[model samples]
Target: MQQIIKFFLRNKTFLLYVFLLFIAVVFTIQSHSYHKSKFINSANYVTGGIYNSVNNLSLYFNLESQNLLLQEENARLHSLLSTPNYSTSLSFISDSIYSGISYKFTPAQVIKNSYSVKNNILLINRGKRDSIKQDFGVITPKGLLGIVDQRSNKFATVLSILNTNIKISAQLKNTNHFGSLMWDTKSPQVVQLNEISKIAPLKKGDTIVTSGRSVIFPKGIPVGTIQDFRLDSAENFYTIDVKLFNDMTNIEYVYIIENVDKTEINSLLKPSNE
Candidate 1:
């Protein structure tokens, strides 16, 4: 107590001056309209800055959730666009069963991806629990990516189009000339399209898309644009170089597409000679 009194006594003159200065400033602001307005403006500017900073921080933390929601919305939109058109040859019951072809799109995050290998595989954070299954076509908003190859209850592996074991049916966007899409382990952004008839009109920068001849993906899903083309060894077909729309190495989110009519389609396509 004695030490405190000694310190306060020593600084009392300076402290008194500081206190009087604060009071004088407040009185001056209250007495002058311009000063009061300036003080209110300064206080508002500071508080507004603080509030903006806090709001930005909150938005930054919510980005992941917002991204996921956007991905899901994109998947839904793609699913609607990819829905198939059924044929008119089926009976009423079959038509009812087939009912304007359906698709199930499950959004997944790419937890791991590989582009340097011949048989590259991508791992995703969706699996059987999410209805992701083997042979499900995977894609992004830009274009096709790959197919799901293996799965557990909570995770799945995708066989990238860059893999040697994969062959996707693709067609020219301007015509019905279709072929098999494969990768030669040469480039991450390019793949090979073979079995296209050499007589088919193709040009540089022509677009390619899925054929929908198979049950994996519906027709018109973009594959890539033709970068170049040349006749195959037998000279009967052209082997095309396609620059893929998706950059395989930079994939983050994808949609797993399940053909709802796959089982029925496969059953109808099976050979009956046995």
Candidate 2:
């Protein structure tokens, strides 16, 4: 306290000049309309700039939350579309037996992704607690991503479509000619569709999609467009190079699809032991 008093005594003349200058400036602005207007405009400009900067900073921090909300909304919309009676006029539908809904979508975030290796895998922020299980199909708004291969209580691993070990049922759009979607470990942006019949009207830019022959992916989920194709050794099937819709290297958000009838379908397909 004594030191503060001594310091104020030492700087009293300078402090007094500063205080008088501030008072004079305030009085001059108040007395002159032009000066007052100029001062107000300058104050507004400074405050407006500060407010805008703060607002932009807040928005930057809120981006992750906004992305999460968008993912959830997307999942809801997908779930709605999977219902048997989805209509433009309807706002909601009950998931009852009469609703005939087979698929349920759960939104998830990718924590880790790999695409350069021969057997790339992805890790998602959903697991057993979120109803994620092995063989569950994962996708984004653009296209199919992969299938869930393993899960814990809070996380799951996906066998990415870029993996050579994974095979998915894909077909040419609007045709019965289907093949196994596989990766050639060559390009991350392209996948291979094997066993497609050569006589199935081969053409460049033809879209390929899920066939719905398996319990994993629903029918008509886009895989890619036909980039190029070539006949195999025996000339019986065509090995198609499909340009993928999703960029596997940049996956962030995903939807885990649960086919509710999968267990029942698998049970029926199992061989019976008499």
Candidate 3:
């Protein structure tokens, strides 16, 4: 207590000056309209800066949640847009709500991807637990990715379009001519379209998309663009080189499509005579 008193006494003059200065500044600000307004503005600027900084810090930590929400929303929209309508029969006096949606899209993140191997495969975070199954088509927003070939309870493996054994039904955008899309194992960005007739009116920059004849992907889903084409040994079909829109080496998120009527279609197509 004695030391504190001595310390205050020694700084009495300085303390008195600080007190008077604070009072004079307060009186000046209150007496002048411009000064008072400026002081309030200055205080607001400091407080506003602090609040903004804190808000930004909170947002920075919530990016992952925001991204997941966006992915889910995209999956819902994709399902609505990509599902095919298979209603061929209509009654004159209709009282039924015809839901055109016959397909379901499940969003998934790629945990593993391979492009250099001959039989490249992709591993995704979703599996049979998420209703994913074999033969489901995998795609990104920009283009086709792969097909689901194997799955467990919590994970699934996709046969990438870069795989040589995998073949997809693809057709030229300008014509009805369709062919099998396959990888050549030579380049990651290029694939081959076989069985397209030589005289299909193909152009250098023609777009190729899914044929929709299969139960996997919907028709008109973009696959690639024609880079070069030449007649095969028999000259009946063209071996087309397609430049892919999606980079095989760099894939992240994908949507898996499930055709709800796939089993029914397969049953109808099955040949009982054989």
Which numbered prediction scores highest in lDDT against the true structure? Answer: 2
Residue-wise C-alpha lDDT for candidate 1, range 152-248, written one tens digit per residue? 5666667788877778999999999999999998999999999999789999999999999989998999889999999988999999999998878
1-274: candidate 2 lDDT, tens digit per residue: 9999999999999999999999888865553321122232211234434433554455565467557756865897789899988675454566455456779999887766678887776767777777777889999867899988766566677788987767999999978899999988999999999999978997899999999999999998989999999999999999999999886866666799999999899999999896
The collision pairs in model 2 are none
Give residue 199's error in model 3 in angstroms.
1.7
What is the C-alpha RMSD, rounded to one decimal, of candidate 3? 23.6
Per-prediction TM-score to the true structure, in the order listed = 0.66, 0.67, 0.66
Instruction: Enumerate residue pairs that collide in model 1.
Output: none
lDDT of 3: 0.78
**lDDT by residue for model 3 over 11-57, one digit each (tens)?**
99999999999987886555332112223221133443443355456
Q: State each model's CA lDDT, in order.
A: 0.78, 0.79, 0.78
Cα shift from native, residue 156, model 2 (Å): 0.4
lDDT of 2: 0.79
Off by more than 4 A, model 3? 1-98
